[model samples]
Target chain A: MSDHKIDTHKIDTHKIDTHKIDKRDWDAHPPYVYPDYKSTTFRGPTKPLVPIAHTLSELTIPAFGHEQIQEFDNDLTINGRVDGEPQGERIQVSGRVLDEYGRPQIGTLVEIWQANAAGRYIHKTDQHDAPIDPNFFGGGRCVTDENGRYTFLSIKPGAYPWGNHHNAWRPNHIHFSLFGMSFASRLVTQMYFPGDPLLALDPIFNATADKIARESLVSKFSQKYSIPNIALGYEFDIVLRGPAATPMEA
Target chain B: MMSNKLKQTPSQTVGPFFSYALTPEQSGYNLKSIASPDMRADDTPGEHINLSGKIYDGNGEIVSDAMIEIWQTDADGNYLDRDTPPMDGTFTGFGRCDCEIKKEFYFNTVKPGPIEEGHAPHINMIVFMRGMLTHAYTRIYFSDESDANEKDAVFKSVPTERRHTIIANRVEEDNIVTYQFDLHMQGDNETVFFDV
Candidate 1:
């Protein structure tokens, strides 16, 4: 381990001055208590969320190095192979992680998990009645490059049924978890496939309210990144919250 | 290429299947987890303590699929940033634990110090689970630091009765210190969540 010492006395005064940064775009986010999503009824807090100022605790985050990710970490098609490939329509998902200011967020750790082509998760709790693909573990991780670009080679996830309501089926999607530069920059959201009919009926998808923000969750087909005779490609860029152009009252 | 100003991707539930990916080590995967519950190293200086808690839904059942993450300053009130190297390499001040099998989450880390003069020693926490439409943000303040807690600007913002919900109960057994802080998703004493 390197013996580099931190200067505890010299605090970042700039961060202290910019404590009143912009809050997240609440209009773009789903309300904590969207009644249509049944689970939110019991899980959502009854009181309003307490807004607090940004501090060193929110501005600084743990840095993950490139050494942590493995060769097949981002390739779901190969990571869990068991004598043969997983059965599904093979596809490639690529995107850039950027801040709201359009600046790339380098070295961000991006993680994804999804159901297999049969709409079944590898987890034991999933009782969707669909067959679980033995060769597909349905979990992958990748670190964004200097340009904030990341790609994953995997099978397209299938729509799955849930117990939320009678005959409830979730739109096909891949869960994404990202950790940007700070605690405030951390985000966990699902990426949906464009033009899926189920997106219209999914309560969770509609919870966001805004049409544009809801559409932002869907990834678009990209012929540019698609490999000939191998797999189709989809692009889903993520924009995390950025510091305000002008300070707001704390 | 998209426009410079872009809308953020909306948050979705973590659902019940993240353990295998986010906390792979605990889920029996060969892949290593990016962050673990243990954040302390032998050379790290501080009062080592075990912070453990269970997550409960409105029904009061243990949330087995919940994952809890924590970020805090070191014992000396210094947060880790890329620009400045940490005094202790092993103390990253970040940890992740999922309540999959045990129905509880635990972190073995040193107690964090106050980041500012009026602030109390606290650990920033986030809760992600299957039922939650979006992850919840909260903080863990030490009950022992009542003096600092009384003066904390953030802690003071919470309602008087609800303030106790964010403070962890301290216990010591056989020279080992432990802080117990349970999170209630709804009903009764629901944890005070922050928008920040």
Candidate 2:
């Protein structure tokens, strides 16, 4: 116990070295520049807000199995009209899991989610005029394959209407969520195609300080299709934090 | 790569446009404090992720009152089993860093263990806010422990390059490990959120 004693204020979870290298040199993705902190003091919560882990974080949207959220291959119950054995795409999304130092680590579990061909999520609230394909639930999941590779078969999501405006619509895209083997590895993001014009207007995509990252989600046109005659395909590479660019404490 | 061109060129927006019966505040989705500073524990000394950063809306605002949690293994290639419910020998390696209303997060934890395959133990983190139903996953491992990391089964699973996402250094100051992990709500440096 004496050997593990830690100084609360002395610990610093930043700066892995006095000579920190540019994260990109060792990293595959763009560098991350952080924002300034408003206040750096630990003040008690008005009334300690206990964790509500049961909500969004705990949701197990059920992987929806190996079929379309709406249309199943030949198994499960198809909720919506099956579009003639939809030959959408089995997009291949791959990327390395880098630490803060831009080093590639392994064993990290990666998860992904997205909307169905109809652009509607199986979620109850966001189901715009669009019908919910009790089956087309894109938000389920898929872990990143070895080699940092992750692949899944699902329809390229379409744009749907939103109440945000007189008639707001989201661009065609899929939502992705990832969790490393431990509680320390967690990430959630949406992957999009290249041609959609909504990238500029999408608030979520715009939130990032890096322009390139926002651009990374879009997939390039690929001639190689796991499907027979799919018109479009999406491939987005996500780079997660590798290691301690700095430390994890004060 | 080409798929990215199509989406950004046209710039289609992705979203949860419809308001849920639960308000954003009630939903715990606002980015209040983006930068949370923390302490790192180490013996010999080294560096770590600052464990800071934020989750922002398109508005570029740090969500206020949001919670962040992370779980991981240790430096010896073993898992942390403090929270397990006492059933098996399996080590349920996990940790938590919950910060309300700041895009940035601060953690005071040690480098996780390495597996037999030489893979360094990594940390898994999750983010929760208003109007969102899923949590993300990302791992952080030691930068200097290459020999141990080389054999980690889970570490080698990802591509060689992507593995960089979990590598961190072991800096020492006052006998404590100092590292920082800044999260990105969006963009290339975005925090790694998984679907698992």
Candidate 3:
């Protein structure tokens, strides 16, 4: 057995604020059983979730190193190309990852996957009747720098049809996954393009009841980051859960 | 300085298309996954065991597109910090597995010791799938650790009747130890999910 001692002091510090920790705002998120999203019927849990304290397990997460990410991993336009350049309008997506305290979450990992410009994914499950771009694989990943910022170059994803409703078509969006400082900070969300008319009709996007929270998922078009005649730029910032505020000593 | 105005970025579903990107290996992508089911190296300490389970939806159908990630303390009950080097360089106590192909997820790692007094040895898990808007958080506790589980505060927080939903049954065959723990999203045997 290894002789590593358990850090009792550190464990105690975390236990003190277990009850006083700031709870996540469930009001801002969609309920588990939103009927409009047809799949939720069989997937959403029926029992009330048991609230528990954040133990050592919940406060820690595995660290992802820079070595794991390759040079072309962040450039989807080039990394997945097969024969020639992907046929689509290239765009750049850049943003900063921050905590609730507004502090930069440096060295965090951010991953993105989306349908191709023709609204088709390079997976066996997606049988969308769109032409697959041989050049576009539609996936990329990058680690946050010192300023908690990451960027990816890819084509603008198109809207896709689903069988949710009679004529359900998802809005143009990209799936994003982030690993922040702690397990509580992990987030898997989708970033939607601004000014998509489908935003009003999409059940998944409208799941979040709060108007402001739902709007926050939309990335704003940025001229400063856009390259002339190359790729348009869009900025999407993410805020993770911060450490709970400890009560003052009596 | 903290800003109250800075609300969290709302969550969205991972959708059915995440396999090609997140769990590339399972989906036949040439790229490597950041974390895999193999969490232990050749020399990692403690009793190495395989934890495997299938996730069932409300209809009791297997969730083939779900991704399960687990975080646990090392065998010595030490939660290694990002900066702390382990006794063996490879044991990170983290694992990620996708059920896209096999319809079940499995992880190989050493059984964790208790983190502190009155706590049970357990693995924290998070579930992400295409249908769920947000991920579900759950923990895996050993059925063999009844003494510790009874005393654990977290276990006590769960209703008595529902506490069994979180325990994993242990089975051994030919020197290989495996823990079977299935998760139910709905219906009769729904697993106890926690909000942390």
Best-fitting candidate, measured by DockQ? 1
Q: What is the lDDT of candidate 2?
A: 0.41
- How many clashing residue pairs appear in each of the predictions shown? 0, 217, 0
- Report the lDDT tens digits of candidate 1 across residue range B19-83: 88898887677678888888898768889999999988888888878899999988888887666
Q: Which lDDT tens digits does candidate 2 get at residues B10-65?
A: 11111232111112222333211111223233341223334444555433456544
**Candidate 1 chain A, which ten residues in sequence have the lowest lDDT sum?**
A1-10
Off by over 4 Å in 2: A1-105, A180-185, A230-232, A244-250, B1-126, B131-196
What ranges in model 3 sit over 4 Å off? A1-21, A246-250, B1-3, B85-87
Cα RMSD, model 2: 17.3
Q: Of models 1 and 3, which has the larger TM-score?
A: 3
Candidate 2 docking class: incorrect
Among all windows of 10 consecutive residues in model 3 chain B, the one with the lowest summed lDDT is B1-10
Chain A TM-score (model 2): 0.56
Worst ten-residue run, lDDT, model 2 chain B?
B2-11
Per-model CA lDDT versus the true structure: 0.84, 0.41, 0.85
Model 2: what is its DockQ?
0.04
Candidate with top lDDT is 3
Residue A23 CA error for candidate 2 (Å)?
8.9
* Candidate 2 lDDT, A109-228, residue by residue in tens: 443445556666554446356555544434333333345555455566778765444545667766554443223223555666776887677554454444655566666655453345
TM-score, first chain, each model: 0.89, 0.56, 0.89
